[model samples]
Target chain A: MAIIFSSLNIAFSQNNDQGQLSGNFSVDAQVYKEDLDIGAEVPVEKMGLNSYANFLYTRGNFTAGIRYEGYMNAMLGFDSRYDGVGIPYRFITYRNDNLEITVGNFYEQFGSGLIFRSYEDKSLGIDNAIDGLRIKLNPYKGVYLKGFTGKQRSFFDFGPGIVRGMDGELFINEIFETLNNAKSQFILGGSFVSKYQKDEHVTLNLPENIGAFAGRFTFMRGGFNLSGEYAYKYADPHPDDPSGLYNYNTKFGDVILLNTTYSAKGLGVYLSVKRVDNMSFRSDINATLNDLQINYIPGITKTHTYSLASMYPYASQPNGEIGLQAEVIYNFSKGTALGGKYGTNVSVNFSRVNSLEVKPTANLDRFETEYFAIGDELYFQDFNIKVHKKINSKWKADVSYLNIIYNKDVIQGLAGYGTIYSNVGIVDVTYKLKPRHTLRMEVQALFTKQDHGDWSMGLLEYTIAPKWFINVSDQYNHGNSEKKNHYYNIAAGYKKGANRIQLGYGRQRAGIVCVGGICRNVPASSGFNISITSSF
Target chain B: MKKFIVVILFLSIGISLFSQSKNVPNVHIKNLNGEIVNAPDLFDGESLVILSFWATWCKPCIKELDAYNENIVDWAEETGVKLFAISVDNARSMSRVAPFVNGRGWENLDFYLDANEDFKRAMNVINVPHTLLLDGNGKILWQHTSYAEGDEYELYEAIKEQSAK
Candidate 1:
């Protein structure tokens, strides 16, 4: 721990030119003690810590960087595979004129990331960087090409399977001399990705090579824009489906996505539709959580912020589902009827997803589903509306309402538990009495007769200038009747320049913590958490 | 472990021997129009530039930018400072950024999208509402993370100092 701090101190102080050396460090640790009342049990290590520091040095057209991660027996919900620590990420690259190359680890993403995406998310405990070689070539002005081949990272070791991918994109408008100033622009691209593994099964004969291909396009005009992508994968076998509907033989998979948007001065509208079937592609056939993922199908639902409103976030149904999302936003100009001294903002969003209609096959290992038809079983649905208004120069208010339906049977992997229909309402306001001091208040309520019944919550936060902030909040499951639990917490923090330290103590009720569309269930516990962050 | 310490000391000494230059990274970001644009080229090269990394899911990030928009027209005249609210929302939530900003009528500030987080990672930004102040020469003057009610004043002060110089 001391050595880690020393390296951070050195990194934070050394920022200069002629090959600049700079980086950032973040460390999160907690002290956990057994709490019988809160169902918090003691772990082998009483103190758990997660720390990371990144150092980057760049000179002229050359760059090098390394990241050190240490998870001393990761936290409660995190996977134990991250028990040890080492330099998991290191890369060196050079870029000049029309060509560039990287010889170590790097993150890359293709169109919509449907066929290939390599990234790292510390919060979600995901890091699947490719360790081999990658190259990019701009042979022409409007043409871009990339190619790479490597093995995926699984925890501290590399996976057995090897991956190879290639992508090429062209800007039609830029490539053609006659259409330099065309009103509508066009961009086209294509990708091919393949993974290789040895056939080791005695009873089943598996293919040594599995491949996926994708083609995408984009068209943009003055105020209208549209983009779409279609991907198809060859037969591959895997057995980690939460649905538990098909588990034997492998079958082909496919995904289709299309989105369009239009915006004016004070109004904007957007809509997108997606359909996926057996699209869980990974390097390792049986990997779970966020390991060895070869593609990412972004969720099509609006991400809510308020606690109650976001209680049931929709994770993308990668296996098989069809979903549609639409949103409209309008702003009334100042000095108008709806817009008073300032203005009024209103937004409405709607989304729905359902399972695929599949017909049973002879072997029961593969299934068939149509491309366009909607299924009967509902996977998730959300409809929400929000309005914001400024009452005066010192006061502002916002109100929101959300209605959501979550299929617990599929989302939470609960066999017979049924769907959860919840309605959330929130009221948030801020008041300023002094030049550098302000008080904000938030009150929210979740109404439902299923699951844990009704829940009510409120929070108060006060801030002073640019240095200090204090917040306290509590949520009560009032309608449970059996166990009306009160999850209470208080936190205080101080900030200056690029440094911040926060101390929090609370009873963490059993729930889920999500980041970047990934979810992790956290067990209930009572303890103290300290976080320190600094960058130079 | 001993060799690690030795390497660290040598690196520090090497870093101290060289001086710094005034150049910001030439990263690319997508605008609301879905067109890729060089980050440092967004400004006209003669004034202070503010990069306020934000997200659609963060509440305070939205508030601080709203405050900047409220007094921006007048503030721009008083001090030649510009603000670009870079949304670090991925594809999962990036599509809504355009509508959200337009819905709020925050058209004064340029709303750029870092859909892939390429620029965010280039700046070593771990969280949203992280603000950076750059000079006319493209060198970062100062930066701060998180936000409070009066945080804007500190930014204004920094801009004032640069203009005075």
Candidate 2:
């Protein structure tokens, strides 16, 4: 293996048209030292590493690639199911003007992913890439059709169920040349997906086949645009969840999503709504948490990056939830009182999610729900406004305020931890010493009486030109009447071309680290971490 | 165990002969109006293009965009470079990318959404705030991962170096 890899690396040169080959490698590892003070238990191996390398060889109209991942005992927050090493992804592809085909491992999605989506997110420890066959055909102009049949990956293995999906899309405007020139454009799409698994339980009979269908449409013109999708799923009863709150009774599912936006020049407004009911489609019947999600319902609220503002983020509820999100963006013109010499940008956003107003009857296959009814229980709400401006050539600042009602018990499954009602404020500033050097700082605070009480955080970062950076930050649970634990970290990074290396030593607070709408719980720990990534 | 390591290494570099700047894959991404455009078309092979791969939910991504916007006029006037901010937001948050960019009044930048992450996976991007500098010939001359407070200065330098050539 070493001989082959060395040969390839040395053999490839600046020679261009000879069917180029490309790939990248990355590795992240952490060495743990038992910290009794912070409850960072020592792993049996004393260390954990996660590494992956992808190689793709493309020539002419054909391409093939493979990904190898190694997790030495897995990371602390990662799923232990990925304890070993294996080649989890590989694919061969061929494409032409009329048709495209792929075999082996692939990722795909239909419309808003209400019915089916196969993708990977290493941060969330979620990779459900399908292993099988996929085909795409454009038989007619302005029309796209795709179909796939495969089994979803579970850790190092494939799920027992075999899932299949088909999607078709037609651009109305393009299909009809007359409409193409019209001011308003339209697009129509539909999808059908299903799963089949063997029924093996002896005590209870279960449906081995579950299917869903969805249709979507969009219209856009000028500054106004609108789109929506409706989906329905066959009866799927799973009463054996770990929580034991759901009934094993047969149940059907449905979801509806609508979004609209209007924008021109410096002002824009957007509104989105989603309704989900009994929509817990999964590759595995009993998969829990961040595992086996066939469909993703992302958070409608803003994604806050400030340490304090994002402390308690909203988690999307794919099953039996209704949500609405609204946002407005306006830029005050330059040279105005509010705009200053440089224009000032102000953005306001609001989002809310609640339980669906649905009731179940004694019927064997049906549930009841009003089309627009909203449940009384509140899951999450976020209201925030931010203003950003450049004070001078060398200085810039941004200030933001956020109000949130986070249901920890419902979202994080913390039984006794009630909903947290908090308000957070943050100020970020950047100063440039020279054209090649700069410094940035952030100060943030959160006020709340629930959970860990009030909190505050501060961060400072310095950068030299493009290749070097160093930073330090700390968050304190100051509102806690008893414990005032400090979560602190210091890190640095160096970059050259497509290669980057980062090192850090820090104490992380025990909490849920979420990306997109998925999350992973990380335990409290103090350790040294190193990461190396390069692309060619 | 040694054999396994060797197999892994071989699989990673089995076909790599020498390292060269590979062209951006011909993946498809959608613009704000939901029109599919080839990924390489953004650069078009005739102009210096800066592709800033970002997401609405990412803070550093936003910061980098803001900084670039603040310096865009100057950057363009000085180097005749155009910037395209590609939002790698999936189906869940894709609807917000356009609105977010529009609301910020960053009209200086163009926005495209990668709904399924095809471009991201094809580009081998593991994180956001990853920026790529392309020459007039559509060759990716330089790329960087992560953003610091003053990374734009280095980017400008790279742009100047490319434009000079």
lDDT of each: 0.82, 0.82
What tens-digit string does per-residue lDDT give for candidate 1 at B64-162?
888888766766788888888899888777777876787777878988998777777777788788998877656677888998877988888887887
> Which portions of model 1 miss their true places by more than 4 Å?
A1-17, A241-243, B1-22, B43-46
> Best DockQ goes to which candidate?
1
Note the chain A TM-score of all models in turn: 0.95, 0.96
lDDT of 1: 0.82
Across residues A275-302, which tens digit of lDDT does each residue of candidate 1 receive?
9888888898767777798988888888
Give the range of the ten consecutive residues with the poorest summed lDDT in model 2 chain A. A10-19
- Report the lDDT tens digits of candidate 2 across residue range A51-92: 899887665456688999999978788999997899999999
Question: Every model's Cα RMSD, please?
Answer: 4.2, 4.8
Off by over 4 Å in 2: A1-11, A14-16, A242-245, A363-367, B1-22, B70-82, B135-138
Model 1 reproduces a share of the real contacts of: 0.59
Worst 10 residues of 1 chain A by lDDT: A10-19
DockQ of predicted model 1: 0.44
